[model samples]
Target: MDKILLNGMAFYGYHGLFEEEKKLGQRFSVDAELKFSLKKPGKSDDMNDSIDYGDAYELVKEVMEGKPVNLLEALAETISERLFQSYSILEACRIRITKPDPPIPGHYRSVAAEIFRERNE
Candidate 1:
């Protein structure tokens, strides 16, 4: 299977269990891996034959900017669902949502959740 990878997509989102985290907002990073057969697109050499990165990015941005969730797991699941719904060729996908510089006492760069799902193809 061939894959289209979107890595280190940074967004400012209001998502957390804490009140201040949701109110003030923080940086979030997303990495998405979309799996599909690339033979058709590679052979045809056509944009329509393959998934559009711009479209995927826009979808991710929309999900990040539209809702205020309290958990990264939910955010990741939403992203995975949206991708599966929007794209026809995707067989499976994985979404990783990371909260960078979380308001935790311990020194940590980020906290993240990785969710994987497959389409009923």
Candidate 2:
């Protein structure tokens, strides 16, 4: 039930339904909540017992910055899938992808898609 939070990780990506969005690209903010038992890490005091969040960040970066997905939902899905794959100790994850300047005309801070997934095994 313990948690490790990676917040406000920013990236530039071309992910949207509009051609202009794909062409111009946009800023994305990702917040990932990785859940698992932290007891081992806490007791061992070793990096190996805990998830290396630096690695997790790179994985999210690859998905967010690599593909030109048209929906934030898909983006979050891919991230969740990869997180489950990359970290064996990860039990569940909450992924939130936010677009700071989406093409939609509105007065708002930003729009985001959030998803929660748990390990299936």
TM-score of each: 0.96, 0.97
lDDT of each: 0.90, 0.94
Top model number, lDDT: 2
Best by TM-score: 2
lDDT of 2 by residue, 29-108 (tens): 99999999999999999999999989999999999899799999999999999999889999999999999866887887
List of clashing residue pairs for candidate 2: none
Supply every candidate's count of residue pairs whose N, Cα or C atoms clash at under 3 angstroms: 0, 0
TM-score of 1: 0.96
Stretches of candidate 2 off by over 4 Å are none
lDDT of 1 by residue, 2-52 (tens): 999999998998888999988998889999999999999999999899999
Cα displacement (Å) at residue 45, model 2: 0.9
For model 2, give the RMSD to the true fold.
Answer: 1.0
